[model samples]
Target: MKWLLAMLLLGTCTTALAQEATARQPEPNTRVPQGVMRYAPSGFPDRIVASPAQDARTGFSVAWRTDTTVGAPLLEIVVAGDSPDMGDQRRITATSVALKTENGSAHHHRADVDGLQPDTLYAWRVQGDRTWSAWHHTRTAAKASAPLTLLYFGDTQNKNVSLTTRVVREAMRHAPDARLALYAGDLVSGGDGEDDNEWGEWFEANEVLPTSLVVAPAPGNHEYFEEFEDTPQERRVLGAHWPVTFALPGNGLAEAKRTTYWFDYQDVRVVVIDGTSALDLGTAKAQAAWLDQALASNPHRWSIVLTHQPFFSPREGRDNVPLRKHLLPVISKHKVDLVLQGHDHVYGRLKSPPPVFVVSVTGAKQYRLSDEARRTMRPVAEDTQLFQVLRFDGPRLRYEARTATGRLYDAFDLVDGGERGKQLVERDEDRIDERACTRAETLKGRTDRCWE
Candidate 1:
């Protein structure tokens, strides 16, 4: 009996030790590598993306990343013809910048291809040494007053491989001729926004789509993360990959050019602002001054502003009052047509405005709206993934908000009133019912109750 009792105690000690060891181990799939370089050449170029230049008709920019083996950036383009001949085409060398990241050192290359004809189709590709990327075709924007359509998404920052992949795919499948893809920021899950695996997933997810799609993204708070040795006093900075990976227009003020820029497509002028840096680093004054100039100089008939944080907060205890205090006056003064934003993780549309403010999310993460927010905003959606398409032509701008599964949920139109202004025309047919909670549920300990 003594021997048996001793064996049982020994077994208990072993089990406890095993449990402790397991507990001490790091979480699975959470280990971030210090660098991502392989000894051999990573071969072909990756993350190939295009952005609208200061002028979209005759100018556009292309950016891509490659391993160190590719010392110089090269691109080849041709005015596509029925039987395009590569006989006289010349390859142009682009500007390459070395980017050393936790994953490894790679070169980010950017080329500004200019002097192309408006609304003309062209084929292009990037080359690394002798290896070349597949030929991709793109067309320049048509002259002002021409019809145009664009895809808009919000907060594609989580589960990019599984969820964002589906959302983007659905949007592209629905609208193959979309001229531009606009994101409201939070493009990755990593707090730093530069994680190699996270970026890889993003690139892979987008690879299946057309490489010519121009991306215009706003910077979110998640794009700025703290970096240090774990004690938490480190200052937050913009993600290392943000500027290098994207080649945007240089039409912004000092220090915030990448996140704060503007470009005109057809009759619409899109003004992108950097709300994260403004609220965190106290750069609001400079950004506001720049926004005033941008709006004042708008040559297009329709104006829209895009940012990560909304001017009006839609969730309880979640607000960006400082952002609003600085930019609302400018928006009002300019009579901005639309203010598109993300980070609320919920969907909301306001009826009141010189500017119609819309908050939406495309990722899987969600949040319940506060009572005040629900009561104030019309047509609020919860736990729904959405993508929006906006078409601008002549005297009308049409907007449709669709779910991930291609269901049209909300629709509206803005008609230009000539000397007066743009008037909102709401389409209420086949709209989904409001998904708000009841007051009775709130009385029974529910916090996300809806308004009557």
Candidate 2:
């Protein structure tokens, strides 16, 4: 189960993790201490997560947490065949790190498994102190750009247990063979010190998805905080859990490291950015330069960029001008196909073509639309938790946005135009009316989620 996101591993998300620190007091936190302790790392491994290799065609990476008692945990992978058998399983060792957390001291292990055959089904598992997890499954990226399906999410920062879990489960049911599951950022609320139990909820919400698809994630502002609280040395730093939670490829600006990385699953290249660092920590210039370089060196037909902060906003007072200044120029220059983003906690997709910018939310949190969004985007929806399923076939990309209950809300197609970029072809046949806050809903004491 470690391989299947056995951590707080059950949930729903169709979003970009637009993790913004709202002025609202007391952020929504759904972590139950008992839940955290119930699955704490002991002899058994928890927080088991898998990330795609830099080149996913024939490789992948996995990470899991355990107690110190399991110093030399066992990892084995075998080509999925006739019956569950380890007779052909290949045993491998992992690099271990000791992580001290508020919950307790635990050991984290990472193993980058490569040299496997492409497009092959494989079963893997981890053995900790005294027990073993269920055999988890994963497939290597196809050797070439073939028909591919993927899932995208915004922030599930809050209400992962109550809301996001169902969203994730729904996505899996919707697209059983999705190769990659991309999270825009802010996977949890307390991406800081109080991060453990929150992550417990996240991992619990993400349950079996990790074992099957590439659990790709980017870091949102919430993923960082002043590690040293109430002290002179206090500074915004990655939470104690980020590094130990995921095994993302570190192929980006050294300053950003694992937080800002990318991977290629097939004919497409996904460039994930650390929007928090660019806007808050002054890594804008270098990060932008890197983006230009990443796209310039690309060998794929389409390039999609994923970031925690969006180039556009739906929340009235919120505008990420700084982020746009650094990131916009590069994305424009590259003619990227899709710029998927989160943070607005609302759904807004542009009516135009190439490099379509989409800001969506999958958690219970939803925001009102902004003046700018109304001016630039269409078919917008508010107060609706949504998920997106994207299908890439040769030169065409089908993008569909469905509500949490699986109702088609917005649908479109990006047709390849070669030098002209992708043409926006709307597919609203099954799309429903825009979902926004109603006066009746507001009168139900939901003023905070209205679109007045």
Candidate RMSDs in order:
8.3, 10.0
Give one digit per residue, the lDDT tens place, for model 1 in 343-387.
888889886845899998887666678777778887788777889
Show the colliding residue pairs in model 1. Answer: 34-102, 35-102, 35-103, 36-103, 36-104, 437-450
lDDT of 2 by residue, 221-282 (tens): 88888557788776678777788788888798888886888788898899999988888778
lDDT of each: 0.79, 0.82
Decoy 2 TM-score against native: 0.88
**TM-scores across all candidates?**
0.86, 0.88
Which regions of candidate 1 deviate over 4 angstroms? 1-41, 84-87, 192-194, 208-210, 228-233, 435-452
Runs off by more than 4 Å, candidate 2: 1-28, 31-36, 191-193, 227-234, 439-452
Clash counts for all predictions? 6, 31
Candidate 2, residue 296: the lDDT equals 92
